[model samples]
Target chain A: MKLDLYKEHAAEYKAVKKPIFVNAAPAQYLAVDGQGEPGGECFEQCVGALYAMAFTIKMTLKAKGQDYAVSKLEALWYPPDGGADFETAPKSEWRWKLMIRTPDFVGKQDLREAVKALQRRGKNANAGQVTLEKLHEGECVQMLHVGPYEQLCETITAMLAFAEANQRRQHGLHHEVYLSDPRRVPPERLKTLLRQPVRKA
Target chain B: MRDRTRHSYEQRILRVLTHIQQHLDGPLELDALAGLACFSPYHFHRVFTGMIGEGLMEHVRRLRLERAAQRLKQSRRAIADIALEAGYGSHEAFTRAFRERFGAAPSAFRRRHAPLPVPDGRAVHYTPDQVIRFSPKRSSRSMSVAIRTIRPQRVAFVRHVGPYDAVGEAWERLMARAAPMGLLGESCQFIGVCYDDPEITPPERIRYDACIAVSGPIRPRRDLGVQVIAGGDYAVTTHFGPYQRLGRTYARLCGPWAARSGRELRAAPSFEVYLNSPEGTEPGDLLTDIYLPLMPAPGTE
Candidate 1:
């Protein structure tokens, strides 16, 4: 996905802190979680579900002629708490949240309505239940990361370390704005901007 | 004073070049061209050479020969007609110019080159060995757009055959035909859709439409008929420039962007919604919105 328009306007996006709403819809999704030797697929089902919900909301906003500024998307997975029967157990869930800012109130309503519609349609093989939430507005530091999605963890680690050294605490949530959709773009060409909303301690 | 004088000279040279390109088929002389530029014959040669990087005779000869080569590959016009249009008093002179430019005579070149494909459903592959070579750099960021499905459109078009230089006359004819029918309303802008091979169609022979898309019933007229333009998801971009450079913009936005994005290119005819026309604005300052139909990548559905 080569978006000439976005690249041309990237500089404008890096300036200032703007008010934004964060919508996190938990669902079944394919994903890998944790780190190192202990890390494995944490909640694949939940990741798939969240992606479907996010995609649905995106489609609904376009249908209403309301365009939103999508700032970021991030997936968090947590393993099941108790030791239980592995085979018969429901898959541990993951939350895929997308942060978007829109000047139009009608556009936000359109997104809420879309989530309701997805919930009404019922969960299937691809999607799960939908949820929406608003993120508090504040200063956030973001850097454009160019390269493959697999190497994104390194960039995220560097950002976190920078925040820690500067005595800035994580304000709310971790998020990623997809500058390039990897499915259409080559792995080496993918661009995803990592953004962390932060506050002074 | 010097800068102002140089600017005027540059403008005159550009105008002369446009005139020569527009009327390459007819006999053209340096005196006549110098008169158009308002320059004295003695200084005109120097000015033309300095501005255009070629002598007056050499530039005219090159343009005419180039035009003849394009016509031979694109149009079914007789070789003699082409030779005459190229300003050769005899077919033999035209043949010599043609051979000099293409390293082959007119008939032999035509035999070796296939007619450039019309902008029909067939996809034309432009390779490195082809006449034009375009290598574009890929952009980093990709835009996320919500796809919208559009309703089908009904249009009546009058196909204008020949170079875009002569397209203005075809458009005038279309406007005249639409005037009596009250089809020339404020809401409508003249739509020109280019189709066919640029390499094959002599600039005079390229196929275009002097057309307008309408919602109501289309009445019968000369060379006018009801045609359905099926609608789908379209990737649109607006370009501001003279109509001549619109093709280059399309090549950049659609040809390279679509190919790199992995999007499926639909066969629908691309359209230009002429927002500003030569009637209301300067030809160099016109604005046009180009639209190309697109679909999701294969296996995505």
Candidate 2:
């Protein structure tokens, strides 16, 4: 059986429940950087383009004797203006990068091939913007936000307070690992793993 | 005492401590311990208490309870099982005893712990390793903190408890055995993995491992265990002063760097890499690198 890294090592994939402190192992990902307001059709298209290329590579590798489950959608958000009020940032000014965890067998060459293959099918996948990369998140404060996307500001504030109490502050881009599919789940019931990378402040 | 007599005494006590730590879940009767110490059963209690600063039974109970509390915080072990593991015969007995020591029920303590202090903090005499640094205006801006990836390492280590100042002894013992194996050199890395926050956990109960990274075939003697230190991205800050003021450097990291960095702490244990030993080096010249584990922020991938 193909090993499920998340299930076998539960701590590495610790769910956002409370403000849990964690250190993450380095993992590979298929990433696409973008600039826009999320929850709009454009962002959804970007997510679709990412998944389309991701699944193409997944299937391509499956045929080569490496079968694995696709990871949940994850995104990094930040303001290009270096502003503190990211919650109320204008949609046009918000910068983001959408990603999915990719296996080691899937490399930069494979990502390029996946993008080309999607184009060959007459679909304009945002394959040009996607890249395969490795990310190492050392220690973090994580929690599950299970409500409307708009309510995330309050939860994030609480998380920031928790980090401040423990002597941590924001360091990298704001990360949200989407655990629930917004299409199937109601906005009020959406579940997202909200994480803020921090350093000793 | 003569050198031979002192050595024997140290060896025998170490043997007893090794046996107790290795088999914490097993019976540690006073008679059996006295036999191991090669002391008369009648006089063992007094001798052990005098030497170790606690009664044998009291020491065993404390160790077991402390181990149980550790498991409760980090693992999903059953309370009844943990109670048994702590050497209590019944749940009620364990509850009463735990409450008496920790000032909370076992479950409550697990949820929001205020750990009980170890009975004796004076295991080894030491010049202090850490002290609160004041007057940040001078040193705060001087610390240069950086984030980078660290590769995984395989190392052999010996655990130590008591004050951070006493951790020097654990390093002493590890090097004693490791040096003969030709494990000390420029190629090898020294790391100290401290698992507890001194501000929270008692100084006497704080856990630390003095480790040396090694590869290839290496024999691990009793009390020396081998494990891998998981390496990844870390926020590293170097302290260029006496070891006592290192906490002030950490405050510089935690208060300024961590609070404003947009990064969060990872679950992995942060560690220190002693760039230079105290020997032949002035206190003002010693360099120690403190590595704090980190992760990306919530809204990032």
Stretches of model 1 off by over 4 angstroms after superposition: A1-201, B1-136, B139-148, B296-301
TM-score for each of the candidates: 0.34, 0.39
Cα-based lDDT at residue B88, candidate 1: 84
TM-score of chain B of each: 0.52, 0.52
**Per-residue accuracy of model 2 over A1-201 as CA lDDT, tens digit each:** 764545654786677657877777787888888777786766767776776676567656654667676677898886567654765667777778899887777777776766665565344446567788788877788888999888888888888899999999888777888876664468887889887878898
| Candidate 1: Cα lDDT at B231 | 78
Model 2 spans > 4 angstroms off: A3-5, A80-84, B1-301
**lDDT scores of the candidates, listed in order:** 0.54, 0.70
Q: lDDT winner among the candidates? A: 2
Per-residue lDDT for B76-151 in model 2, tens only? 8999999988888999999998888767888998888555444344442111122211111122355578998878
Highest-scoring model, TM-score = 2
On the 0 to 100 scale, the lDDT of residue B268 in model 1 is 55
Model 1, residue B114: C-alpha shift (Å): 36
Q: What is the lDDT of residue A91 in candidate 2?
A: 77
